[model samples]
Target: MKRKYIVGLHILFWTLLITNNVINSIAATRAHNTVIDSAVIFKDIMLVAGYNSIMILCFYGSYFLVSPALFLRKNYLKALLMTAVLLFLMTGWRYLLEFWFFKPVLGFDNYKGNNVSVSYYVSNIFWYYFPKYFVYGLLYFSAENWIRNRNRQEALQREKLSTELAFLRSQINPHFLFNTINDIYSLTYQKSDEAPVALLKLSKILRYMLYEGARDKVPLHHEVEYLNDLVELQRIGSKGLANISFEIEGYVGGQEVAPLLFVAFVENAFKHGVLNDPDKPVCIQLKASNQQVEFSVSNSTVVSGTQKDQTSGIGLSNIKRRLELIYPGKHELIISEQERYSVYLKIQLGS
Candidate 1:
């Protein structure tokens, strides 16, 4: 997650390791109940710290460099060859440090005054401590490789999810503009007095639509105003023959909703519900509160050859999938048909 968190964990790991090493050093010094001077204790710690520094550096090389470049990159043959070379060199390095450097320069080796042969020291380095060092290096390498793979998988998942979401949201634009543009054309072709007004209304709606389409959410007043303008656009050139009504029961001052989320239902109402009905009004109601928003649309079902079937349109299914993806468990949708057709939607907008 956060860089600081990962750094903190590394710090904690190093702290615990240093603490354990210090405890073991202290236990060994006191094993024979021998009184030790501060000077001797400090020198003992210096020698132990030097060895610890070397091993930590070795482990990290395996963790950060070799694992990714070889082991994780699937160069198994190269990884094995490199590892063998490293171990051979480290064995020689350890023998020189303990027999030559520690005994002469630091005077910290256990057999410092003894006449032990060079082969004896080499045997302890290669046979006794080499396996432990090799195992520790492998542990570090495997742990880092696992973290790398996990992070890669998570990044890929997020990218895929966002790409699909963008495609789904883009589908809304064409489906919506197609119907609105048709309504505007009908007014202009009739040479109706409302043609210019409907065109102007369409322009305003498009201004909002073009800007807000890319956004994840839009404010309450913007959506409410768009819905109102949409109804008025459909009402153009109607001459009071087709009845239509829109109602709002609560304030839309601070609410927010996904862009173009409510339009498909409105468009479907006009298309398949009341387009040919002169006396029956397509009723739309929206109620918004601090925590929730609800919308219901009802109209007389059209039984004309020109009317599109509501159940057979692309708009309904697209919006249904959109709602499921965007709101999931936060929304409820209901559709009923017997005489009049109606669709109701309710959403919990968490504050």
Candidate 2:
């Protein structure tokens, strides 16, 4: 993944701000003294620097540690009381340090020796420290809110994409089923003997598609079961109607595959091959392993007439789009023809 540029920039900005302020303070200290090196200036402010660093980090750390638990437990009143007490204690601590140690050592006795009114100290504390603390607190809460909103938006977008893909897959499956059922309806009307066997096979295919195939994924064993049912349906229906053969090779353990992903090519074979002529043969071969599945279907077609017939076809196009969406760069598909036309697909399931 690429680095987060904004986070790096934020760290860099804070470093520069801290360094610039420290250097400026040291320069001011050096202006009035003869022993005005970086070392002397650091020694003069060392105690102040140490105390400020510890106090500032302590305040920020404590606020973050408590705020989430306080909000989650719905203890706003307790949180507010604790915060107020902390601020009061911090104010007293700063005053004590200034009066007892810093004033004597740093020559800040003008503010301490003169009985500066209570109002003077109160104003200095409120104006100088309150805004700084409030702004830091505000930024912390704002970042949390921004992160939550971005997550929510991303979730909504994923749900939308999933819905659209499901609809597209639905369109392909239903169209194939409806056409085959209509063909069965015509055969049953003529009192054909193969009608009962065809109906039983169709019921099995429908049951699997409506139940198992509706899921996000199904076991490879279930996919093989559905394919067997589909081929049986085609075989029985095409006995005197057309010549067709379906084949499968290789072991498929308990791996999973997206439902109806391989069915489109099967449906296309019948559409383009079965109705053309009883003399013409349609052949489909499937080879599967733990890591890959290879499927190929071949059918002869009259190019001009078939092209016109395919104008409203959604089977092949829908399958291609669904593969792109689900597998992305993990799958390959090639469709072409020689003296014998064919559709070939190879998919690699992630390990």
Candidate 3:
């Protein structure tokens, strides 16, 4: 798409340039002959078309012909030297063909009569044709500049995305650690015999975080194991009757997904849903198939006059941006809040 847009822009620019030059040529002839019209303009454009053909031919062909050798030699100076030589030859040929062949064929009246000399030809040829080469050179330089800036912009975007992703990943690991440590602290304070079991579960989660989750993507099985471990921590923290339920309905198969993609949803549920009150409970369902994965977390929260303080929504927002970058049109996210808050996210892999 980008390349097509650039090409379209270049074509538009050259079309305008050629149209302007045609108008100027006809206007110049009209100044002296007083017999210019659309026919004259068309004729002048046709006369220049022969040289323009050479300009385009050399512009595209000669560069490609020498580019391989230039790259092989790994010498920029030599490559530039070759380019200069090719330009000179092409310019000289264009000048020769236009003056010696095209001018006479078009019945152009030279102010100096039929006789042509080095000085006369040079004055006529250089003045008339040099500007065409200047136009070509300008076009080349502008195109190169456009390409350079485009590459620089793409590089910056990639680096920015990488940095943001790393920061998001960093936040995720520590967030999970904070929650796990809180659970461990509760277990220790209560002097519960399940402290050893909680420690073991923490160790497993930490091992996955250290090894598997650090990667760009992790196996489906590994992520499920981590999710189960997280649910176990929630159960332990809930003291066996917290009314929190997590269910996975479908097989994940052997597919891989981006690490920690499910963490934000789970964390939000645990943070807001796991209340000490027996009247309210959290319901979370996660399901995956070959084509899609869906997560739904809904919880009951009462409307109150007190201010509901929430931290920066960066974690969930980062997940949103990652979905945009990685899945784009293949994902859907719906967030609804009322007496009950719910988040539904579905990603279509096969789409």
Candidate 4:
């Protein structure tokens, strides 16, 4: 909680207390059906103010001094001893103010009889003012502590989320880089002219990854352009043998999405799915609207005699964790591996 908000709550609490006192005084005066004298009302208000000023001091003394110094440390004996001292001091202070100052200078006294004794005055102060204000001070302290702890917890949670997201992004960048580098290496080994073109495309993609990918979100069009460049780079490396279809529906320019959110699925498709078969080419589709974004990637499953790729699931697992952290309940992800390997993702964009 901010200091200003705490101060505001203090002001509100005192305002209500003073208002209640004033209202009760007025109600008592009305019950007697007497004409309200302005001087008497002023005197009553002044007395109420004087008494409440003592209460304010007592409240803060417990809140800022006694409670932290003793009560919070579980020094109950010393806390009780200190509280007893405080109660007597405050009672004596009010007694002097009412008797020596207000009664003499302002012509009024809270205690009206000549038979008043020290014991009665002390009892009145202890039962009426001390318990009420002291309890209020302790309660306020507890509430403030609770608010501070909750805010700290929330801040720590945000920091943890940021760190985890950064780690996931680190994995994503290297994974994509490794795959793209291998494709380029294949071109270089074959002595193809398209290797230079692929290198140039790779440079642009790297720029986007280093700059835009570091951001939490980017314009949807920018992400779409990145995907286009990546697909083109892969095509160049394939020497026109790879068959891939990329499609976009609805307006993509007006929205924003998490950067590199869909790259893992695309990379997984290209890595494990048939790329040369025209009848079963890699298919990637993205549809966007004001309220949601839908993305899917599907490819024909390759039939190889070799065992499943041990490293193939890394990108998919990284993306799944990222989605859980970033979207939580706001996104849905579905993966199917029957006739074709397919991944579908839907994200709700509304706040």
Best by TM-score: 3
Candidate 3 backbone clash number? 0
How many clashes does each candidate structure show, in the order listed? 0, 0, 0, 0
- What lDDT does model 1 reach? 0.69
TM-score of each prediction = 0.46, 0.47, 0.51, 0.48
Ranked by TM-score, top first: 3, 4, 2, 1
Tell me the lDDT of model 2 at 176.
54
Task: Return whichever of 1 and 4 wins on TM-score.
Answer: 4
Say which prediction, candidate 2 or candidate 3, comes out ahead on lDDT: 3
Best by lDDT: 4
lDDT of 1 at 126: 52
Predict model 4's lDDT versus the native: 0.76
Look at candidate 4 and tell me the lDDT of residue 159.
Answer: 45
**Candidate 4, residue 324: CA error in Å?**
2.2
lDDT by residue for model 3 over 253-316, one digit each (tens)? 6766766677666667666664565676777787998878888877786322122224423457
What would the TM-score be for candidate 1 when compared with the true structure? 0.46
Q: Comparing 1 and 3 by lDDT, which wins?
A: 1
State the lDDT of candidate 1 residue by residue for 58-121, as single tens digits.
5664555456556555777777676666655556666666677777777776765677765775
